[model samples]
Target: MNISEQQIWDLTNQAIDKLGANASPDMIRDYVEKEIANRHGGSLPTEKFEGRVIITAFGINKPGIVAKITGSLAEMEIDLQDISQKIMQNFFTLIMIVDITSSPRNLKEVQEELARVGKELTIKIYAQHEDIFQYMFRI
Candidate 1:
């Protein structure tokens, strides 16, 4: 099928309606969620539970970038386990590691939130570790 944006969206809406009519609200929600997740390629990546999210903030650095970054995590109740930073070339590279809650059963939400903030500033998150180099390039 020649699936266009409009077609995909229409199908999703129809699915939502069918589920709503046949099942409870929770069931519809689950159906819509499953449909959405399937669109992202079956299943999401397995996030590293314990790793650092290194963000480099720049571009006038804005005003509330720092607070927004920390605040979002705070609202999610994700614990800021550790942080490191340095200012160079008028930029702040904040490498933070957060202890995400197990109840959520996923780190994608936290990653998505970080990605949204990155669009506003020069931000990046890398899994920093001594063995990363040895495992990757083996150079």
Candidate 2:
């Protein structure tokens, strides 16, 4: 029921301690993996987003920017799954993950509309597939 990454680390430590100081590294790793799998059924179910789009916007900080950006999504029937925005000095940065599978408009059309909005708002908006985001940020 929603265990955090830190909690998982703590639980792994406790499990390893129970195996005593002489426990091998491989044994500890295996034990922790199995314990976590047993608790969570190996993987957590997630909502599938076929047309997942990541949008990043940055510009001078001002009011109503969020409402305007999200309003565009609403008009297109796009689902805004997650969003985060921050302001540093007079600059504003926003990142949003949206589900565009159900949208009536195509990806090109959506990006074009967003570009129009960006120009109007004096902000730069970029829209790309989620896979690209994952690849570029992979460690």
Candidate 3:
């Protein structure tokens, strides 16, 4: 039968206590480590993002629109991972993937600032985390 990691840890600790070997804390830890290493050679790395944001903006095509949004991101030291912008028949559309790992401002502040810029530029802007985007668009 397959046992969970927690179960293995609990059983190890209980056995140690019952045996009363006067084992040192380090020894116990090493034993557990060796046992886990033997059971599982190496654990796989998890997929994680420090911070990710998907932003979409649409409006009547005009100049300096992309500049305004990108300027805010640059000011906050946010990394622009990916971006796409197009203008067709005077309608502007832009989508961006932003990394906020080293940004000085939080997500809320960035959203608010983008909203303010959108109002000034007469465009609509929306931001959502990558995970939320995935969930909403999941099959």
Candidate 4:
């Protein structure tokens, strides 16, 4: 049975509502899987789901920061799933969710590249697999 994107979204929304602010990534994932199994009378679909990475950077505000970072990701064929950034005065913080399944480089390579870029720009950047990130930051 094929599940539409809308179905996934609805399931995700329901999970969020049920779990509220205490929900971790693993919790949501498990909730969705259980819901799908209950509704479809089987396990999740056979489609492969690639792991994602979380990228975070922060430093004094400067021009071309986003451009440079995104450009490097593009060069490595990384797909940006979502991004949020905020700048206050001279400081800025950026967070991004990226899919590196298409990239020729692995997570460590990506982190090294981003670290180099951050050093060049005098900022701080960190990358972690979503699972590790979620585990480390669980509420």
Candidate 5:
């Protein structure tokens, strides 16, 4: 079965509630895995989960920044769902909603690739799965 982002979020919340505040990362992971397995008749899904990711980048404004970033994303076959950007004086901030379901690279690999691009361009780039982004930024 292909898991949706909402399902992952719900599972995470359930794990937190059941495990409490003191749960280690491993414990939470194991709990979620077991829950998924139990729900799926003792086997985990083999397909990759389809989800969107929020990509944020910020640094001094310069030429070709968007091109460079989008170029890398294109190479990975990640679709850019939407983008918003602002330039204030010499600083620039960009936010993109990307669909990674078709991408060959996973979230971590995409992050690493973006990190390398950021380092080369002297900027900061971050990629977070939509569920994590919502949880972190929720009011």
Candidate 6:
């Protein structure tokens, strides 16, 4: 089904509600898939390894976290497709939904690279792909 940015944003917001700042990458990623599919729009084939990466970085929410993560992803040749930035007291949350069209590293590797940045900035990251969604709310 064709997806709109607003709808995606709304879905993203819903995910944020469930997956706070401390949540793992897999958590939010699953929401996007479940919500999209549960719309009764039917299952959307998760194209090859071509998936989306949702990066949740907490602290310095405005540009700092976003810049750092995006910059790091760029270094890894990962492209950003959509993003949501939420800032709270002394903490910034960057929910970046990225396109894995040209990801040079796997999700775990990408997470590893991100860990370095988080270690430096004290920001925690949770990274995951669309497939993780299937198991999120499974029986």
Per-prediction tally of clashes: 0, 0, 0, 0, 0, 3
Error in Å for residue 115 of model 2: 0.5
| Residue 17's lDDT in candidate 5 | 85
Tens digits of per-residue lDDT for model 1, 1-139:
2358986788678776776557777776677667656776785435545443333344443466668788877876766777766677766566676566432434666667677767655565433332454578786
Judged by whole-model lDDT over C-alpha atoms, candidate 5 comes out at: 0.91
lDDT by residue (13-115, candidate 4, tens digit) is 8987899999999998888889988886575544333579989999999999999999999999999999999998879999999999888777778889999
If scored against the real structure, what TM-score would every candidate get? 0.47, 0.62, 0.61, 0.61, 0.63, 0.55
TM-score rank order: 5, 2, 3, 4, 6, 1
Q: Give every collision pair in model 5.
A: none
Order of the predicted models by lDDT, top scorer first: 5, 4, 2, 3, 6, 1
Model 6 has how many clashing residue pairs? 3
lDDT, candidate 4, equals 0.89
Q: Residues 17-134, candidate 6, lDDT per residue (tens digit)?
A: 8788877878777777787777855774343456787777775544466677778999988888888876578577778888766875667778789999888778788887755765
| Candidate RMSDs in order | 10.9, 14.7, 10.5, 15.3, 10.5, 18.8
Candidate 5 residue runs with Cα over 4 Å from true position: 1-49, 136-139
Candidate 4: RMSD over Cα atoms? Answer: 15.3
Better structure of 1 and 6 per TM-score = 6
Q: What is the lDDT of residue 133 in candidate 5?
A: 64
Q: Give the TM-score of candidate 6.
A: 0.55
Candidate 5 lDDT over residue span 1-139, tens digit each: 6789999999988987899989998998899889999888897755564799999999999999999999999999999999999999999999999999998777878999999999999999999889986887896
Show where candidate 3 strays beyond 4 Å.
Answer: 1-50
> Best candidate, TM-score-wise?
5
Query: After superposition, which runs of candidate 1 have C-alpha atoms over 4 Å from their true positions?
Result: 1-60, 102-105, 125-139
Ten contiguous residues with the weakest lDDT in model 5: 41-50
Error of 2 at 125 (Å): 0.6
Candidate 2 has its poorest 10 consecutive residues by lDDT at 41-50
